[model samples]
Target: EAGVAQSPRYKIIEKRQSVAFWCNPISGHATLYWYQQILGQGPKLLIQFQNNGVVDDSQLPKDRFSAERLKGVDSTLKIQPAKLEDSAVYLCASSLDRIDEQFFGPGTRLTVL
Candidate 1:
């Protein structure tokens, strides 16, 4: 009955600093996703999780970015040695199934200096 939840709605860091974002998906949802929206650009999928397993992460920069959906309910995304270009809104969404329309949470805005 609850919508998704995210913490620390905003974050500020210098380049090379590390940051982590958290997400709690809606109940009964089976698929979860993380996305990054850079200024002026549409959100790009960063990772997809079906339950506790990874479904897709081809576009994610594994060298600096990583994510996990622990126990198939809540998730976390992290960036190490972050770059200025990493500044963006990090969005979390969930759906009943992979093909279902997703419900999104208010994103976490990260500002890298």
Candidate 2:
């Protein structure tokens, strides 16, 4: 079982710019996760989904950040009008379920200037 795969390992953009990230979870995984990890801080759960239905997303910034998992498979996360505070490593993870061990991607490093 290989780790999840994310594209464009690094991204740099000005404040207010928009960016989208793609994630492909491991095969047969029933749960997917998105997290934001700022410098010096632990990864924060942005959203979680179980088989295409949102399980939890209270920590997500709904005003500018959105995500979707289609067919309970691949997922995407987008941040519009990116803010300086949004600069962080956006990580994607997956598990058999909420309590299962999570497999994480290397992450997309977003640098907002």
Candidate 3:
């Protein structure tokens, strides 16, 4: 099966600017997740969606970050007034079920200057 897809493989922006990342999960998958991975650290869950409804977003930085999975398929993540700390790899993953194996996208690497 086709894997996850992501856009703008890389991004460079100044602090406080706005940026958005897009993702398309695997077909037939029911669970999608967005994660932020800083250098030398594991990917931290930002948000999780089971189909069109949100399942978990405890780690999402609501102050400047938001996301949506309107159709329960593709999704987008946006950061308005981005912070320097936001300069990291944003990853999108999907699983057939909550306990199933997850497939990850290539990710969007953000750099803040």
Q: 1-113 in candidate 3: lDDT tens per residue?
A: 79999998999999989999999999999999999999999999999999989999999989999999999999999999998989999999999989999999999999988
Query: Per-residue error at 98 for model 1, in Å?
Result: 0.8
Write model 2 residue lDDT over 4-41, tens digit each, in one string: 99987999999999999999999999999999999999
Task: Estimate, for each residue in 1-113, the C-alpha lDDT of model 1 and write its tens digit.
Answer: 89989987999999999999999999989999999999999999999999999999999999999999889999999999999999999999999999999999999999999
lDDT value, residue 58 of candidate 1:
99
List the global CA lDDT of all models. Answer: 0.96, 0.96, 0.96
TM-score of each: 0.97, 0.97, 0.98
Backbone clash pairs for candidate 2 read none
